[model samples]
Target: MSSNFTNTYTIHMLCANKYEDILTQFSSPIEIEDLWLAALTEWCHSPTAQCNLGTNVPPNSRIACTDPWYSKLRWITLGYHYQWSERVYNESKVGEFPSLLYGTTVNIINFLKHLIEGREISSNNSSRLLEQCQNYTPEASIVNYYRTKTTMGFHSDDAEVDKEAPLVSISFGPTALFLLETSEAIKHEFDAPLHGSFDHVLPIYLHHGDVVIMAGKSRLARHAVPLIFFDDDTEVVSKGALRVSHNVCDKIVKEDHNEGVCIHCQECLTYIRTTRINMNIRQVMPVHR
Candidate 1:
């Protein structure tokens, strides 16, 4: 924790409009048929999912999604009840030893408490990119997703958390294609490029180590996940194109009064033990009234 986020890059971005400085304050934008400018290809997987999932095909694979299974903001079935993640659904909480590999890479919960109450909280530094999320209300339990050729569909991050505040997303795995649109672009039209003059549609190659922050006016802006590509037009450049990341959230599931008591029988008890990893960082604010 201390080592991972000992630096103030995340808090700096939160307080400062550094992200806006990148796209707006910068000069002309350049496009290419053989280069990835937005994709930051850096190696920062502590215990790497590849090492965990064994680079398998079906049951061994995993999807690090940020939205629930039913949120259809961008006309996609994101935040809904779906039987995804074998390890998660099977009540298998692997990775017991808390190495600098997984678990809330960059924690915003401590940072917010530090800001508001001048308190210092400890965290882990597993090279997980910090995505600081803030809001004017409470948040639901977070969720995860991995958008490849299949699995999850096009959707928005606003489904799990409150729709008022913006979502701070960070890319952590292989490079994948992402499409972000607006309400006007996908209000009622067909799936033809999500038409609209105000379309912020982007086929972002969310490569490893890259952090794409969507906030402010673009927070509620409708977005979607399109697809990913392996090779470009010609020669093969690099070989890191599997986009995997988690949105750290402030949502925590408080157990019922049952606490240590078992509510269901042994069969049901064996089921609801393990939970899905919906690591999303949410900005929670107290009620004014």
Candidate 2:
């Protein structure tokens, strides 16, 4: 199994060694492995369901959107009903989500603030002056979704994010394959060679306890889930498990109101997007005149 995951084949496991050194410390797969994110899974799954995260499509919408950036990403469009978005985004966001899950986004966002901080940050009322960004143009949150059996088109991380920002994410429920294709050339050079190799098509086997770190050129590198299979692996599936992950990125944008979420959004509610949680964790800088 170790050899199958070497640099020669799929993604170079930057965290494999990190994971190996500590994976066994726990009794079972626990979110705590990823520390902050682990706690989040428990927090999100809890009854409170306070959420700053959500999938763009319907809970059962079989639609899959392709990456406007790549074609291999098309392969990930399986089980996905369609592969596009038609709504225009606007200025107001963070107040309404899922419409089905309205009022919950705020709780989730506040929770994120608390997560980033070392200490606790209670809601507005109990603020011990722990922290406050009290007023800031909310970074337009552009969210898409991946459903069970749905594939994410292959392409580099989103373009909305400016260069030099880390993509923080959160995952919840249902296991899926996350593929990161990094060939020898692409690994080090953008124009070195357009070699099509599965070397980077790494399926991030996520299940509850998983965190994806996207930064540097690696952040610019291509990634996606070409396909989703139940019991995709007899070994892992027979045990009855699924992968879920979500996170925040360090990117900010003004809701165009003219160009709504391109992948998944309110007008596209009937999308039937899966129930996976994705968030952004990045430092936002105000635009300079």
Pick the TM-score winner.
2
- Listed per model in order, the count of residue pairs whose N, CA or C atoms clash below 3 Å is 30, 52
lDDT of 1 by residue, 61-152 (tens): 22222223211111111112122342121112122222211122223332333333432212231111122333232221122334323333
Taken over the whole model, the C-alpha lDDT of each candidate is 0.27, 0.32
Q: Distance (Å) between predicted and true CA of 174, model 1?
A: 1.8
Model 1 CA deviation exceeding 4 Å by range:
1-148, 159-161, 183-200, 230-280, 283-289
The most accurate candidate by lDDT is 2
* Model 2 lDDT, full chain set: 0.32
List the candidates' TM-scores in order: 0.34, 0.38
Ten contiguous residues with the weakest lDDT in model 2: 71-80
